[model samples]
Target: MKVLYNHEYPRRVRLAAIGCGGHAIRNVFSTHPYAPIDLVAVCDLDRERAEHTGCMFGAKAAYTDYHEMLEREKPEAVTVVTNYDEDGRPRYPQIAIDCMQAGAHVWIEKPPAASSAEVLDMMRVSEATGKFVAVGFKKMFFPANVKAREIITRPAFGSISTITARYPEALPPLEDRQDLHKMWRFLDHIVHPWSVLQYLAGPAESIFVQRSPTGGTVTAIQFASGAVGSLHLDRGQGSSSFLERTEIVGPGGNVVIHNNTKLTFYSDGPKPAGGYGRSGDYYGGDERAALHWEPEFSLGQLYNKGIFLLGYAPEIRYFCQCVLDDTPPEVGTLDNALEMLRIYEAYCQPDGQHIRIDTEPGKVS
Candidate 1:
């Protein structure tokens, strides 16, 4: 795939943005040159932020109200990045609905909603409007994870049998789980590993979560594909440490991704140099050696940019491709958000017992 500059595309979708906050500025807007967008305008509740972002991005139109921006700009696509309300309800859901209703497709930031019902509501509206919506499930877009995805699905890897993910997350105390504001931290970040699991193993059908007194959790999940997986929530890990690890095991081999950048795939290759027990050397032939990949930062390259390495650019580029080609996005859809939120809701329930995740429509179970 070719990475195009803003001017390289023959025609570009007219794009406007809601919320010019730090994330929108640093990650979303920075991807403009890599995605095919005309950048019609910018909107934020604060006048100075709206104007400043518009000026910074060469968008001449600026509005404090998204409604005004949507109506006046007539953009074909809109990207939203907003924080939570006083009640801990994310602002992205309602804004995304508004964007879809205004005849534009949407690309919204994560923590898509506070509940599964909210995600369902977005789903219903998206179907009604014939507008596609993409959520920011960034981990699924990470270069290393993307490569792992490709490697595992190839015929060489055989069929996936298990998955293991480690991420630093803590479940709220049982008493605090009932409060949306208190549980906000869990909702905001759990998707990092959960989305990766879904992206690799498909939807989980059942889960049994066990929590520690120290606030950590270990969840055993049964995927609909019949692949079992475990998610390790390392609650007390230091802030400076590398954040994540994902490993997928198949009958033929296992692939591992470290901190979302380095990837190593161990296929069922031949034994060591002379044989398993007879070899003096541990190394094997190059044809059957573990395949490894990681980005090099010494040179200037699109893949080396934080925007690309962290998935911000790729996700935006994907959304833009879906809009440009008029194809529905298979990744980061509201259906995926609903599944992720179902798992979040399961965490709210009393742990120890297995919780079955339902796939039906309507209110959250």
Candidate 2:
């Protein structure tokens, strides 16, 4: 629990970065100051972007070739924030495997790979090299999601029975499922909610989908924990609508997260002394009342920033901490990514198709 200031951590993890795109610039680079990492070099295929980002982020070196940068800088870890290939497959799986082989742990961006098979390949490399790899599944680290997890795991919350999550994205028509480019948006975005669901509910056992003409999808999921869940992919919603909502139900209690910011938890409580008809006020005592949390915007605190509030900084911090602690990441690991990919595969198939998710070899039911 030692908080390392950026200037004071003289022995922080030596790190290199391999992208200078918009996400890298806005979220990834800005997060290193809050992590136990000293970025030593920045790399991108575009040399100009590499140098500019290096200068902006206080990296001492820049390179157009990541292989050369990995060899020369020898960072303890590297962040791969690059994008997809021409064929719409992510570039990070190969880059991560190479980084691990080069003796550096790796943190890669979401949609870890095009498929579960690719994620499994990266998992194999991680095992062989003994270097940990993690994907930035930021939603699982969001304050609201974190709080929901805390609430549901409490002994008083009873056994979790159901979950419902909503996210804004469109799954392409069935005809386009085979086209990687056509399905690119779905692949890139589905990981956000899938990560959150698996984080709270564990691995899913079976899945079925129902799609609408407007390109939205509602997936019915059955988790291994005997939990039933629904994922609503909200496409064509108004541009001004705030984006996500989630609710989880246990025995006599429930937790809800709205727009990824507000969290409200309702606990099991006795009825008002008389009855619903006799109660004069709606207020329940503190012990039985709902608990609510949302940030106040008046303070200029670090926690008020979107990077921190929405989870980018915390996710990066978690990755760096695991590297410093010499432990495999407990969350956001390759195994987690593999489970998410199985969910993604379920979506690629038509409704009513029975898809059994395989969490381990010979483990599917």
Candidate 3:
């Protein structure tokens, strides 16, 4: 298979899109024109919204019910970007299962399911139907995060000793977790950081957490790789402030991502010439010095678009390409979804108590 690049002859993948909501309108649907997909149909519970999105994206048909759309269109694949219910439950697993059973591949949005049980069901359906299902874990699709994954996996970086992820979200207190309404906000948002952790480090072995009175939650995680990690939910940060910051520490180097866009790598360094009080300069011509990357917004290029810069376009293209080649997706597989759900469930229990996640190889906790 050809490696996908920014500009290339597009390989066509027939597709049906589901959900005509704000997220699909702004991110998923907008990215199809740039990917290797032909939007053949659109489906939504609201007929008017479905027709509007279908017409806007040049789809041939629109339907209020996804089952009708799948039966009529018989698309090679389907994209799902629906919103969560008031109870924080995801509605995509059943739809995805139906699409897969209808002989179409599926690309469902993040928070693949409300719980790990749902993900297991989707996996069983996919296996039985011989169709692949790729969850839209968009954070792992970002260029910076991709590069960070590559960096952390290198031999020179050694085994990752620690990781810290910061995102502006809040988890309800333990007492409120049983209420689906109270947990809904967290269920919708925690997938972002959870995906990153699973991508770079691997499955979390165990987790201990603390919930703040102000709605924020803090977690300490131990990965199967024996690396420690911290997840800080910042409920009170100003929206104007950088939304995220992540750091991964290895033997003699570390990588830091600022605001989800800028990435800097700090490698082994030489000692300063003078004493601690009289250091000469931050940079001293060391060969193994730091490296950094951030996009320049001046150019009116494809990179300037949020869909491209933030990984939405790349992720869509990846799914389409996998479908065209009859291959499974690497980033958003059922196994990854299972790991993410494990972390989500860890927060449901009270703080300072460890939760064990069952895995194929062994027990995680």
Candidate 4:
């Protein structure tokens, strides 16, 4: 619930941003004022876009070349949001590696790479430069998802047994899977469900995907901890419908998030006064009732802002906090990116088979 304005923060990291695309402008740069950083410059390949975005925000300068921006501005950290390479691989890994080599930490947007091998290269660069790279796995920062993670970690929650997620996405056909460009869409969007899933249920070891004729898919996952899960990528779901739902179950209860905002935690309640069908009262004690939360937009609260509600500000803050503290980020680290990319690689394989994901923790198979 902490809200710190960029200008008011007595000491802030020197931040520069690359990529002036719609998403970077809307979600990332829009959050600059709320994060703990002084945006020194904006960079993009398009000079007009760079200048426009820099002027829109309060950046002191703008440049068309990021390498030039890095050398001239010497920002302590940089946020990168870029398009994928022609091969369908994200441009982030190489960009982030370069940022680290420039002696600055990096915050890059998701789908960190097309494969685990690329993430591993980023990891190597990060270690060599001693600068951490934080991927924008925003769902991990979503307030509801954060709350769900908290609820699941409580001792009262018992062991996490399962996770179920639904997202409106479609997988490429088996034939198309061999081509990175053909997998462009799946690589871009699958990270949403997988980010929330991995954020809740750590370290999955395998996945079994079954694709519907219409391109929807039901992916079953087995975690290293012995928990099982499923993701329903509803390809043909209504566009107007809410995009996502995620739930994690524990022996004591479960927590669910709907549409990235509303959350309900159903905890184990007191035993009924009577047994089974004989129980007359459906009500439970005050403390045992289900806990629920969702932001109210009426007052213009920070939580009501799309940036905060959808996790952009929090993600930026988390990365900035790490930079300010001179420590590696705990969330959205290269390890997390690597883990998710491994699962992404699993998706690139033929569907309808139980593909084993490499689980050696950041080691590319």
Candidate 5:
């Protein structure tokens, strides 16, 4: 298929995919037609599923074993989106290392590893083989989240004073946390909120949390940037409830992302005098003052698709672009994975204790 580009379509990257499961089938495979990737093969533990996906996506072959797929296909890149093991462990680290060793860049799903040690091992292999591993920390790629990053970095936003992130998830109690099986659900999902906080606020200096009897928890985090933040895990919330709402407050202005898609920027407006009440005017400034973006379901637009708007497609495009350009991914890099692991480890211990993270240099320490 011919790949389209804004200016000129560059050479598409040959790709092999691992794990033909629900996420891969729904999001990743659906994105191939839009990205600069040529899907050459699909592999899964289930031979039937792999072959089905391969036939559906026009892959040349399918295999039950990823190693055989990698050895035979020798594609430039691979996408790993398998499920966790019975022990609540991620199974992609070894597969990713194998792919990197075979001279292919890898893009794996979240919770890059079951532990920090696994990620370090993959990092070592990636460095030794001169290949890259991009974890799908898709929150960093969300259009609203990306815009929030830009807003916080602007001089006018000043030094980010605080951030508040709300996601519908709960952490296991401290006693149960020791068991990877008990904590598996938390470990798998905590990366979502952690990625958002780390991307916008920098590394967390310390964390203090309180868990509820029913399994909900609230964590207060202090960033190395000297910015404070809060994470609220709503355990009892309905699954149909809005999953995310984030806000970043700087010296003057602030940005709020409603439901993970609508972004609103409240720029610095003139303060009222002592005698004056709230003004009637709702509009803040000219074209530059207020900005917002949300999909109009009424129209047939690419933005309406979950693949494009929900961060999966854009993230795949990002990895493909990095490979074609021979550049390291800014997001989903090993360093980001390390930071996320640190947060996961911190939560494993008891709450109300401070755990300091060693952040990278020049990062507002």
Candidate 6:
């Protein structure tokens, strides 16, 4: 709970950043104030952008070449928030591998790689170098997701049996799946919901997708834990509409998250006194009734800020915590990123054709 200013945490992990784009400026760099990190350097292909981000984010130096920055700064860790390459592959996997080879732990934004194979390669390098590589699967760290996890994992919720998520994203035609450029949108944003789903329900054992004429698709999933799940891709929704919704159901209880912030947990409702129609009251006591949470704009609190509420700061804090504790990250590890890639791949398959995924730990090969 200690909020240490960047300058006040000189003894914290010496860290540098690669990519001075909008996501880094708005979400990642702003988190330096709270995380256990020293913003020592910033790097980007564009010198002006890199220099400006360095000055803006309290970094001591800036460089055009990430290789030079990594070698010269010798930072204990590096954060990468770069975009995709010209071919539409995420630039992070290779850059992350390079950072680990340079003896620095890495935190990169998703999608971690263009394909599961690339993630597997990153995993090999991370293992060989003994440096941790964490992806910024920020949705998994959202306050709502964290609370839903807490609710479902609790003894009162019994065993989680089903999950349903609705997200606004389009699925490219199957013919274009192999072309990275054609599938860029699918590869990029699909990780958001898939990461959250995997966080709550370990991994999907089998998946079957149904496509729509409007480009959206609905996917049915069977989790490894005997849980059935569904992901509805609503590409036709208006931009003003809420983009994400998730519901996790267990024995006699359920949790629902709407628009990524508002959460309602309906704990087991009272049993019917005699028959279903014989119940006298619909509401339970305050403690037994559903609980709801959302940020109030009236308060000038950090929790009200999107950087925190959207989970950017906490994700950075978790990465810093892994470095300080000398432990590999549990949530955003390369393994989880690989799983996300597999899910994306499954969506690209022919509609209604179930694809079996290998969720077991280790490299895909």
- Give the number of the best model, judged by lDDT: 1
Q: Once superposed on the true structure, which residue ranges of model 6 sit more than 4 Å away at CA?
A: 1-10, 272-274, 284-287
| Candidate 3 residue-wise lDDT, 8-48, digit = tens | 64568889998999989999998876788778889899989
TM agreement with the true structure for every prediction: 0.96, 0.96, 0.93, 0.97, 0.93, 0.96
| lDDT of every model, 2 decimals | 0.90, 0.88, 0.85, 0.89, 0.85, 0.87
lDDT of 5 by residue, 94-135 (tens): 889999999999999988887877878888887788899999
Ten-residue region with minimum lDDT total, candidate 1: 356-365
Question: Candidate 4 on 56-174: residue-level lDDT in tens?
Answer: 99899999989999999999999999998766778998889889999999999988888888889988888788999999999899999988888899999988899999999888788
Q: Compute the lDDT of residue 10 as modeled in candidate 2.
A: 53
TM-score for candidate 6: 0.96
Q: Is candidate 3 or candidate 4 better by lDDT?
A: 4
How far off is residue 227 in model 1, in Å? Answer: 1.0
Candidate 5 regions with alpha-carbon error over 4 angstroms:
1-8, 272-289, 360-365
lDDT at 67, model 1 = 94
Query: Which parts of model 3 are misplaced by more than 4 Å?
Result: 1-10, 86-88, 274-281, 286-288, 361-365
TM-score of model 3 vs. true structure: 0.93
Which is better, 2 or 6, measured by lDDT?
A: 2
Collision count of model 1: 0
Looking at model 5, which ten-residue stretch has the lowest summed lDDT? 1-10
At residue 234, what lDDT does model 5 achieve?
Answer: 86
User: What is the C-alpha lDDT profile of model 6 across 1-365, one tens digit per residue?
Assistant: 45565557556889999989887898889888888887899998889999899998788999999999898989999999888888888998889999999999999998889888888898899889999999999988898899889889999898889999999889887788889999988888899889888999888899988889888888899999999999998877986888899999999699999998899998886654555777787564566667899878998887888988898998998898788887999888888988888787777778878899988776533
Residue 89 lDDT, candidate 4, scale 0-100: 78
Report the candidate with higher lDDT, 5 versus 6. 6
